[model samples]
Target: MESTLQIMPVQRTSRNFGEYAEEAVIIEEPIIKQKRPLFIEANTIEASLEHLRNDCIIPVFAKDNEATLSHVAFIEVVQDAT
Candidate 1:
């Protein structure tokens, strides 16, 4: 079986509070946006890195999405322990 690498986007938010002079203080809350996991073909650890570099997997995964490779996390490699 071929190995697979799982990558997901990370979200971040900023808070804006009105000045003390302002009558109404605006309190913003942090919002976290999640995206679907992206799977890549990786038969081994080295192959995984090669795919990420040669294939430019970052943009491929970020295409038409706000997420970026920097936000990618939970990189999992599924292999048969035989």
Candidate 2:
């Protein structure tokens, strides 16, 4: 069966600077759709992750059925920001 994945905003930032400290600042914005990861649908989280890795797509996280494959949807992504 085919499925559809939802796309969301992924925030990113960059440092902007000119000739002086007055112009130095951090610019934050949502990542561009063109540069964002492509949505992929799969029956299982494992399969989805495998496909992402195989395609060299780095996902911040994704939604999938429960670990028991009970068809209960949930967010399944981990972030460890130091």
Candidate 3:
């Protein structure tokens, strides 16, 4: 089965530091939806990112399934800033 991937633009609001510090707000704008496979053969994060760069989709999990998959329903992508 094919999975739908939604690409959205993330906007970060300015932060205010004062007596009451306000947290930055994040806004997501829907850009486009692309069809991709739910699973793929990727050994590392680089491999998964490669798939995302070339195929425009991130694999939810590796096909090998070597480790325990998360029970969370939502998918989160975390990247290092450094």
Which candidate has the highest TM-score of all?
3
Ordered by TM-score, highest first, the candidates read 3, 2, 1
Q: Give me the candidate number with maximum lDDT.
A: 3
Candidate 3: where are CA atoms >4 Å away?
A: 19-82
lDDT of 1: 0.52
lDDT at 60, model 3: 56
lDDT by residue for model 1 over 7-46, one digit each (tens)? 9887877656544455768999898787744554333244
Q: Write the per-residue lDDT of candidate 3 for residues 4-68, one digit (tens) a residue.
A: 99999999998765759678899999989887545643332443534544665334547874544
Tell me the deviation in Å of residue 74 in model 1. Answer: 8.8
Local distance difference test scores for all models: 0.52, 0.47, 0.52
Residue 79 accuracy (lDDT) in model 1:
30
lDDT of 1 at 60: 38
Tens digits of per-residue lDDT, candidate 2, 8-73, equal 999898667554467558989987756544455333245464444456433343465323321112
Residue 36 local lDDT, model 1: 48
Candidate 3 total steric clashes = 0
Question: What is the overall TM-score of model 2 with all chains considered together?
Answer: 0.18
Q: After superposition, how far is residue 58 of candidate 1 from its true place, in Å?
A: 2.0
Question: How many clashes does each candidate structure show, in the order listed?
Answer: 0, 0, 0
Off by over 4 Å in 1: 1-48, 59-64, 70-82
